[model samples]
Target: MRKPRRGAVILLIVCLFFLPSCEAIDNDFSIWDKLFNPVWDGDFSSLNYKATYPENNVTSGGNMEAWLDIVGWFNMSRINGTDYIYGDPANQSITEYNAIDTLGWNDNMDWIKHELLYDVVNDTLIVQDNITMLWHHSEEKTTSEGHTYIQKTYYYSYLTVYDSEIIPKQYVYDGQNIEALITFYNNSINPKSVIFIPDKLGLYSIDYTYKNESVHEDLMTGYVENNSKGIEFVNFTYNSGWSDPGGNLSHIGVCAVVKGGNFTPDNLSIDIYTPYEQLNITNYNLSTCNLFKGERSMHILLFPILLIIFSPFLLIYFIYKRAGR
Candidate 1:
């Protein structure tokens, strides 16, 4: 009876300790599942672009062109007319004008360039380009109506990337918006093949041979530098230098064609995967959770055992009380 009572107390104490760990394991797995299975269905064009200008009214067709260049959208037309630039998308006419061109000019445009900064922080998967406008000159042009001063603002644009999904497999093109189809060849795991494409232009190539043993910190570092370097610590020493004749091939990931490389003009595909170090860390943590949760589950399963162990003592105690009464 004494042993039974002791066993029951021990089981309950063990279960109490295991419960919190079990709940924590469940929560961690939930978040891991969400993070691993990334979907690219969100928009990638809402990134912010900033530019400064004066208060005078002026034709900003060039500024609009620069902004479009920075955004790197599939722009068929230049700024105002039928003259096409960038990728030739088979007679697809993009005829959207800014607000200043439409409203103040002659009220014949769909979009407008107002004196507002483009904010795209909370926007979903939208890639925004950074724009800088320098007030060069303000000239007074004598038109047929009256003397109107036109503000000359020099616009400079920079391209940055922001994405909603981890691009495990996709096609990215160099100097074009249309991503070319490339395939991934996994040498180790079941001889799997995945098709990838490029999104921007740089030195695009394939690296199917070398498999790193750890999560390539350079990839994350490069991403941070290209997106939000000011808020984060980024080292771009390897990526920012001049390219050799054969082109720099130290990094392994999907990239644009303009950067540099042995671009074959064909599929320009590559195969990349999460490193074993990263996988090991992930699995170790998961295994720890599994063990902890398994102990909790064992405790849950042992509840009847606890009840059985204490049943005789409880029965004796009740009987003793009745006899005393």
Candidate 2:
């Protein structure tokens, strides 16, 4: 009777201890929190403090100060807006926009489905109906020549809706306008290239290239003289050169044709180029920069860690059953 009573008390205590805690149930949404994380919450922008790109021109310098100062992102304005606006956590800027992150609101992984349904056909990353204008991601460098390159691909495809109808299924965005933004950081010493096409009945394609540093900006916008060939080929020597600490300031050029038409009534292919001269092209992957330094998303490994943490409960249950036998 004493032994049985002692076992009962121990079992009661164990049950109380093993029960889920309210604190665990109250876990905050990490995704939403990370989205609103500000680079400069106060008046850092108002102050006349202009930050220089990394000294070596490397994209990620593993500097805490740099990340702190240059980290936050502003709310994207409408397709046609007068000025940029900072995002408010309480309010959403783009109603239909979906973040490209791996997790969803329910913590269920559904990015793959979204990619196939939207990202595949749009020819652009559609985040909440609004196209991702500029994407800044880092990649690791392998060889000496191309150690690492920071890819900043801009998406400008607009679906013009007229009379409640989707006209011109999809339009090729102006590469020239997007190229101007690239020059703000890099120099144009290397050669550049571009390809463009106007849709006669459907969608047209646009492709352009710019170097790390260059002096001259190349404006090569070509029309599809022949649609059957897929794309018209244009080869030109790039004379423009820009300064760079990495030494080589050049980029390989390539383009593809999606549509074709004749002289006047048809559309014209338009593209331009200007590369960054002063900025250093560091060899590193942008996506995993934070991970390399021990900073990572806890959500990624949460499940596995939890499994290990709870495994002891199963062992205790088995031991209890054996003792009862």
**Which portions of model 1 miss their true places by more than 4 Å?**
1-46, 50-214, 217-220, 223-270, 273-325
For candidate 2, give the lDDT of residue 68: 15
Candidate 1 lDDT over 1-325, as tens digits, reads 3466888999998887555433212222223233333322112222222222212222334333322212222221111111222322211111111222212332222332323223323322222333333323344477788867665543332222222211111122223233334333222211222223333112212232212211122221011111221111111111222223122223234322222222232323233221111111111000111221322234333569999999999999999999998
For model 2, how does the per-residue alpha-carbon lDDT over 204-321 read when each residue is reduced to its tens digit? 1122222322222223211111111121111111222222223222232322211211111112222332110112112211111122122343433367889899899989999999
lDDT of 2 at 82: 19
Worst 10 residues of 1 by lDDT: 279-288
